[model samples]
Target: MTAYDPIELKRIRWRSRRGLLELDLVLERFFAQRFDSLSPAEIDAYKRILDLPDTDFLDVVNGKADLDDPEEAAIIEILRAV
Candidate 1:
């Protein structure tokens, strides 16, 4: 498991808060349930994903869109699985 500083984790949690309620719920649940166990690469992927446009992010979470980037896709898969 990759250990994150509390500040970084706080920032991540903040970013996970999306404009859409469904996205927020899904991401918050994933953050709470999986963030602590993420590998460094996965954590990075999660951060990158947080930068995605809200619509794209929602589509990814809902399995309505596909990310061409493998790392992003992997992170989305993990989020959806959780």
Candidate 2:
């Protein structure tokens, strides 16, 4: 199994914090519960999603927006489930 860098994980966790309280909670929970186990591809997808605008990100999390990338969509599904 691949070991993730602790500093990178911390940076990702910091990026996960969103302006919306609901988003913040969901992301924080996901990071706490799942971040360490994620594959590099999944981690990349999560980071890309974090770069999205707050409105678009929320829409994707809330199931209002559909991601064109399957990898990203899968990651969003996981986030929503959290």
Candidate 3:
């Protein structure tokens, strides 16, 4: 149960859209732990995005949203990667 740095989380938030860094980190950790058998930080970010409207989410990624939200940017980044 290695502890993840909250400051790193903050930096991730500051540098990325809302919780993108945290979400990416969490997903990476989850897969690493489950498939690689590595103990990593718990990921709880997907829960937030799961409920967001598709248009709002797409708008954020497309840079058409006016909310100036970071989480949207993060979603775009992830979506593009996949």
Query: How high is the CA lDDT of each candidate model?
Result: 0.84, 0.85, 0.42
Winner of 2 and 3 under lDDT: 2
TM-score per candidate, in order? 0.88, 0.89, 0.32
Candidate 2's TM-score: 0.89
lDDT of 3 at 77: 50
The model with the greatest lDDT is 2
Off by over 4 Å in 3: 1-43, 66-75
Residue 45 accuracy (lDDT) in model 1: 80
lDDT per residue as tens, model 2, 3-80? 667688779888888889888888878867876778988988888888999889999999998899999999998988
- Ten consecutive residues with minimal summed lDDT in candidate 1? 1-10
Compose the digit string of candidate 1's lDDT tens values, residues 1-82: 5666668878888888879999988887886787788887788888998899999889888999888889889988988898
